[model samples]
Target: MIWYSHVNEDSLPEIVCSTGYNSVIAVAGSGERLIALLDNANLEQLFVVDTNMSAIELLKLKLVALSELDVEDYLRFIGAEEMSSRERMRCFIKLQNKLESSTIIYWSKNHHFIKKGILYIGQYEQFLSKARPLLKWFLGPSFMKVFNNDYNSFSKFRWKIVKSVFSKKVSYLLLGNKDPAFIGKGVDTSLITNGFQELIDKKEFHKSFMAHLVFLGSLKQMDIEFLPASQNRKILKKIQAKLKNREIKIQFINNDALSFLEDNTSTTFNFNVFLSMSDILSFHKTDYVIKCIKALKVSNKCKCAFVFRSYLRNHIDTDIIKKITALGYKIKDVSNMESTKMYKVHLVEKL
Candidate 1:
């Protein structure tokens, strides 16, 4: 059980606290942020939810792994503003070992599906080779930098949108076009609708729910690419070790947005906050919005909130807006366009 994922120390807690609800139903990205927030805030409980079973297993692995590192290492590895070279290498080795092991295990169990993806891409071999220039233009040096452990540079390359497209192809080749939560038909779309603006206004259900997207990951490509990089292997392991320590029970669900909002009995889960990263606008189903409203009714917590933002226009569902306002929830508009590039974060809570 290893969620071979890394989280930016700074952003994790902010999103966890965004809803202003002390308790929450959250999407666990690598469960890295969820775990870190738990440790830092010492919040009694967090329901880590996702559709990806691999994500669930991986988060469990990371939670177990983090305990191995001391608090200073956790701060340096997971919380530091920057890492010195010696510290970086020290962390690198720790992260790498777990990645190598997990990658091997992943391929081992899912080999056939993985191989199928490899064959599909062989048809587009030439396209892929030419793709590098375009990819390099966007993903930038960080895509290559992390793999090479170019510690000299500080900024990360773009979210690796360019690289991610290719990586999906690679993942498709081996994993058969779907991992735990991500798939076609809008299963877990981190990209499909990211920058789409006009489309947001078109959703029929928006009148009833204040819909928005979360764009959950920071440097989207880093977890997939860098964690598996030869140079990054060690750092990946250290990151894994840090996660292992937390002893959190994290689960990956791999369902759609609506399915995500429900409990086993079909009630909207009773939690304080719901977090989404950019998939709000991508939802083609109305049940998802209904679930949110239902969840609000069930919440014992005074303030229930859903936080959303996006890489495109932060689509606010006009109907949902009216409904929440009627329910006495105040919405705060926060912008991070410079940092997140078209990103907007909203904080909503019941007065």
Candidate 2:
């Protein structure tokens, strides 16, 4: 199952600015972030790293779609434009020729998702769709209006009721802590309630596609326009031009990230690198991941920027930041600038 349908981090600016002429290595989460990076950054190569075969296949399909289809067809085909299932299937059939044999086989079995639109195919997304009605009831009628204008206030009684439905006990009951379909996919038990609370408390909820998905279960027209990967016209044009000129190469590696890094450290030391470690550190032992990162072979001739995210609270301890700093790097917390407001983003650059 696709764990994410789009990017939750708002680090595109960091990724793009720091990635000029350098090689990038990013976790291929949802493939949307990778698409955006490809469009905006002048990278010589992009190493798409992920252990999940399904995620790799999804990115492969996306690459072919971006290369083969025009802007409009590409949007509609990916479910960003609300096309009919038959139309999307037809688009997929047209693009299937450019796909690898494994991708073709994967899509052949999962054509049902194509019919519905690939945007919301994630198991977490489906769960959100099923929960939308209940969420609407709890959010009351004014919540949807936030997308149109501003966040409307809820009465204390309404707030209490909403909180009850999303209480820790109830949430754990509904979304088990161990299920790969839920928490394992990074859908924290408090995500929905916290998202709603954030919307109620913050005025910028309208700017976030993630907030729309958490609250509305589907993308509104505004949300569609705000999607950096699919909606940015200039970026799309840049991507098409790069693809046509064969100026950039995308490599997909299916392996544990640490192992891949260890194996490739010899070759990577020659090039300036920007690594996007998308929330993987949130799941693994912090010391283990940090140890792997510290083991990377780099030299004074090249620079490296390593960005990682933590979704459930600020997962990075003070000692961890010190550890990263002790490795001859400077750290910046870009969480406030993050559009999702759901992750604590730490951008560490070797000086």
Candidate 3:
């Protein structure tokens, strides 16, 4: 499996917000961003494609949870908060019968992942788990305080500290030097190295926060985008309502993006928007991406949006734009208005 079981997107919902598209094609990383988009917009159909079986199963589990469990139970189950193995088994059993036999059989062998909670299995989550302690040791308890309270005034000084902590040397040692066998497929080490460097340069360390933080000497608390404990219940409730009403149809296909596009010969489904979350540009070849674009049956006003990590914007954006343009699309750079400045967004419209 390339991506374990975690959500990798932060700005997809913000990009897709209020675009009332009838259909959407998205990558199912953690499925959180896709669900967020669903909650934010009314869609008739959603096609989520991923190459990893584990990721596909994880999405299925989340859908079952949303469809069956209430907000509190869903939160507890995913958050892994005080939920025992027996409790997890009970929840899984309930979810299992609700899912297809293939899904149940696939998950039954991976009960260990279920016990720990699928949300916590992502490679990005694992990285954050290891990096958080190191960050705390280096920045101390007041680290987030400087950003939240007086970031503008102290940004320069704090940036220096960030640079020292996340320098190129450290990033290369930790991410770039990983064993190829241990590293999942389609994971580019160079991109990871560049991503860390970009974060330091942008002084956007808050993007990586995996939990809520109670800053020192302040009653105010901040929630991270990756896993906001407070928002889980509301998002789940919205998804459940949509599911119950039969307002949305979400299909998960366990195949690479290019293969998924090529395999589907049916011209019945035409998507108005394609949300590419940097995986295609970062991992797959440009030729394959062009093929995928050619295979997709999009509307005349179809807009294909791509979100790239800061580091990749300079390296890959031009090539991607050129390729998409060659296939008869006009390019629009919407990165300036994006709330999460950590990523660069580009929209390609049919000419």
Candidate 4:
């Protein structure tokens, strides 16, 4: 199944989906997080495998529903056409199945912009206490653009000297992609601190602490450390639904790669690439690697790409690099220009 939804409004679950699995195990319609990684790695089929038909049914329902829409209509259906504080909170709460408790508490309790949510959704007031500041007028134009969630069109952002970097279009696109090259990918970014708690970036998140640092003072109140990852009620609901359906397979051992072996079973795969990150790392076992490599190599359809990471201080041994390079994969250096944004991924796939 295939779908196209807006950057933030889309309903997609993340997972560690693998390619060259020897079969069309499954495809997940809500596999938003996995799709970018899977697409980057270039896999062929996602058969939608899951022990729980409930999960498959849910994603299938979403995909079927979305397949009928272009991006704009879906945006409006999710309340993106107008960024009402009420609508925002409503939509966010609707996603509670995919969110966490911490995020719900954080949004309702600490996110100052969310008090209107309490006003809008009478359902959550008892769960919350404090109210957001009356600063809707104070949030600058740049903040409005973000509030609008006009996340694309980075090519036109021209206010280099005056606007906050968050106001730039590039930051928006990179933010949506979750690619770490953007400053918004890390500690200061919402997706990290907001998406998953354990994954929150600790170094540079733009919290009250960062705000305090900018304005030096002889004596002032300050919140030094970043906030812990908050659970979102929306994500939890969605996750619960997805887990109930059972399409994603995340067991570690059951999943790997090398080349000498071949599968003679009659099969056809519309593969464009086979990606790998661990190439004879000794940790990934040369034999499994060879099997994976051979499966892709034998396929008449795809090529491969291999991406790996190294310590900042270490250079790969030229010989080892060359030997892997001999497998016909090219190497490219990744630059983390957006320290705040985050999509830390590496792969070896059909080039």
Cα-based TM-score, every candidate: 0.48, 0.89, 0.76, 0.31
Full ranking by lDDT: 2, 3, 1, 4
Task: Report the number of the highest-lDDT candidate.
Answer: 2
Q: In candidate 1, what are the lDDT values of residues 96-184, reduced to their tens digit?
A: 55554654465357433222221112222223334435555654555344333343342433443432453342533343333232333
Ten contiguous residues minimizing lDDT sum, candidate 2: 176-185
**Stretches of candidate 2 exceeding 4 Å from the true structure:** 13-17, 153-156, 167-192, 223-225
**How far in Å is the alpha carbon of 65 misplaced in model 4?**
1.5
lDDT digits (tens) for residues 1-351 of candidate 2? 687765445656454545563688888878877777775455888888998889999888877887888877777887777799998889899988889999999999998988877777876666567666787877677766777765555455766676666645446447433333234433454654665567557776777777667676655456445765555666777887787677888888998778788886775477888888777765665675476667677767888887777765336778888888787788888766666656767777888
- Per-residue CA lDDT of candidate 3, range 1-351, in tens? 425344444544344532755667777766766667676454778788888777777777877787788876776676534577678788989887789777798889888777876666666556556665666566565555544533344345554665554543445347433423124344333443344445445655344432222112111233434443223456667768888777888787878876776776466344555555444454544455557667766545454443333323233457877888888877676655443333445555557
Which of 2 and 3 is ahead in lDDT?
2
Model 3: colliding residue pairs: none
Report how far off residue 117 is in candidate 4 (Å).
15
Tell me the spans in candidate 4 whose CA falls farther than 4 Å from its real position. Answer: 1-30, 33-58, 69-72, 78-271, 274-297, 306-328, 334-340, 347-351
Comparing 2 with 3 on TM-score, the higher-scoring candidate is 2
List CA RMSD, all candidates. 11.9, 2.8, 5.2, 15.4
Candidate rank order under TM-score: 2, 3, 1, 4
What TM-score, to 2 decimals, does candidate 3 have? 0.76
Give one clash count per candidate, in the order shown: 56, 0, 0, 75
